[model samples]
Target: FNQNRDQITEQLFRLFDLLSITLSLLLSMWLYSTQFSQQYFIAGTLAMLCYLLISSATNIYHLQPGRDINHHSGLVIFSSILTFMILLIAASMTKTTADYSRVTITLWFFLMCLFLIAWRVSFRRIRLNWFKDKRNLKRVAIIGANDIGNQIATSIKENVSFGYQFKGFFDDRKESDERTAKNLAGSIIGSFDDVVHSARNKEIDVLYIALPMAAEQRIITLLDKLSDSAIAVHIIPNFFIYNILHARWHNIGSYQALSIYDTPFYGAGSLLKKIEDMIIAAFILLLIIIPMLLIALAIKLTSPGPVIFKQKRYGINGKELIIYKFRSMTTCDDGRAVKQAEKNDPRITPLGAFLRRTSMDELPQFVNVLQGTMSVVGPRPHAVAHNEEYRRQIGGYMLRHLVKPGITGWAQINGFRGETKELQLMKQRIKYDLDYIRNWSLMWDIKIIIQTIFKGFINKNAY
Candidate 1:
């Protein structure tokens, strides 16, 4: 019975996805034919593929059916924009832009986006109605009435789209403790062994083994017994142990399976980010070359030092790297016990003062982005002395190096850009860095880049 239910759910989900894709394609075609040319068909196809890839990466499609559509709609929009921009840029670069009509392309984009949003909303409504009818729901039973199991039951009950009929739980503990077993209520069907019997008898379609991780022996024993039954068994791992940020599993070579404690940009995500960085960096370099040359010449004429300053800083994985910036200070300190620039530092040159306040001195790091040592967006790299000073004081400070340091980051834009004179300020910056890692998305990177254009460049703390 469990197997049959799994097959049905799988089929239904596939059908829904197919219908969504079909509707999106039709909308694209209609918009293209009416306004844009046939060339946009290629754009539409590529956009769809990008959406699917990014959606999978972000787990948008894995959301249970009854979940709120509004909560995930923002993610969908972000993914769609990233995909659309990439395709649009690709089309322009290939010199095949004439293949599609501009009107068609515009109309197609607007219509397709609307279609995706509408379809998801409609799908959720239909699934909710089906679940309320109880005609296509699965009878689900919990193995333990512990905190985790109770929480799971509560979530299932609240999320009607999960389509789980709570048939109750099976625990050996006596029901005398009213506080612990209050939520479990009358859902306690039988003992652990009785769950197996009910599953074997095709009474329950799903079995959630929510026993604590410490009960390894009992869990193993139960799994061994469950092997003979046909019920779908799912074990809920204790995720409270580690601060997991987008945790996943991957295989090394053929047989080596390892769980990831950090993000994986080394795969497709890495490739996409790198491509974005290179393109943006190249454009920036071209635009700033003349201005950068003027600044270099001014520094050479006005100050007795090199036009560019190289400072020792912590790079990706906490490794030391030389960060290049337009020389802003008369005295360069790359050693231990470095002091941050104050309101009126005698070391800052006249031109350097203006550049630092305006953030023009950091323009040379676009070259670093091209050099593969930095990203267009990430936690801003700190001086080596600063890294040493803070790592001892800050918890999870080194985790920021999990990815390459960026020209601008979430912390910088939110007023944590420079001079961590206070310990709490550094802690706040590290928190933002971890948040970026926790919710790293291409759309987020783009959003940060956009925000930086308007607000990140000119900050009072920059000097």
Candidate 2:
């Protein structure tokens, strides 16, 4: 019944979007002229197709219950803009730009945007009211009494606006003190058998299985007991035991596989990241071209050996990549042991010390971003020797390589930049790096970039 409801809602959403676009087009056409034009009809149909394709790809039509109205509005505007761009491209390709009236096209685009926003706002209003009513809430239960189960209960309890009411926990373990069990946050309502009985009576609407992966037989038995009922069952996998590194689910033909360690960038996300890197790198390079040239000249004149120093560092997924920097020291250490630059290090020349303090030495890494070997924001790549040494010394240290290294990272913004002479300091830096990877988002990247611009560049700790 829930499946059918979802299917119906999805169908309605699509139909509503189609109707909105069609009505907007019709209104525009009528305002321009009473007579129907074939060119306008063709353009309208193409626009609708563009909207459908783009919206579906972006999941713009999948309206979650109690979803924020502003978020949906943003999606609507984004979809509308993409559709408009597609229409313009199609018109240009067909050389039929002059055939359709500009006023009508403009009217249609704005009207479509207005209609989409209005529809979503109205839907959100009604849905929020529905969610506000306690009687309409779905009863949810969690199986097991472990960490994951407690977390699930806490999440559900905190998100009361999601239209789910916690129905308590169902664990097989017997508690000697009923008072203690009753006082627990996810109050132990009953045993496993009682959960099966409640499901049979249609009391529970959703059941989340948070049992350990080792409890295969017990989980299977519980499934069998609830198989005859309509309660929806979900399993929350516990990957904390193995110390997951950027884990994600993948389907291999008919089998489902869980990747314990992997890069997050895939498909559209990878494309978006590449585009972001290229656009930002190109802009920044254009602005700093002369500055970089001056820095190179200073390095050559002041330092005896080279203008640019290349260091073999670990890149994405632990692959070796040559990192570029303005030679900031008298001795170029690209060997087995590379010492980190210190505040009063004698190797740093006069000009080199100034560059290092202001972070001008790392400007060449923007070129690395353009090369697709680095990101504008990510875990800063350590030298290969440092990576090898730290991986053994620190737990989950190597997971930072799951993403492309950055010029400035979350660790840098939070004062973890510069020399790490102590193992504990490296551990703290690694902790921030892993946190950045685990919580990576395009907005998060942009935020870090903005923060870097404001405060990350000039640090007293950068030699």
How do the predictions measure up, each by TM-score? 0.54, 0.63
- Could you tell me how far off, in angstroms, the CA of residue 231 lies in candidate 1 after the best superposition? 1.8
Model 1 lDDT tens row, 291-381: 9899999999999989889988889888888889999998888878888998788999899999998889999999899999999999999
In model 1, the Cα lDDT at residue 385 comes to: 80
Give all candidate RMSDs, comma-separated.
9.1, 8.7
Candidate 2 lDDT score relative to the true structure: 0.82
How many clashes show up per model?
4, 0
Q: List the residue pairs that clash in candidate 1.
A: 35-104, 36-104, 37-101, 66-161
lDDT of candidate model 1 versus the reference: 0.78
For model 1, state the Cα shift of residue 48 in Å.
4.9
Best candidate (score: lDDT): 2
Clashing pairs in 2: none
- For model 2, the run of ten residues with the poorest summed lDDT: 175-184
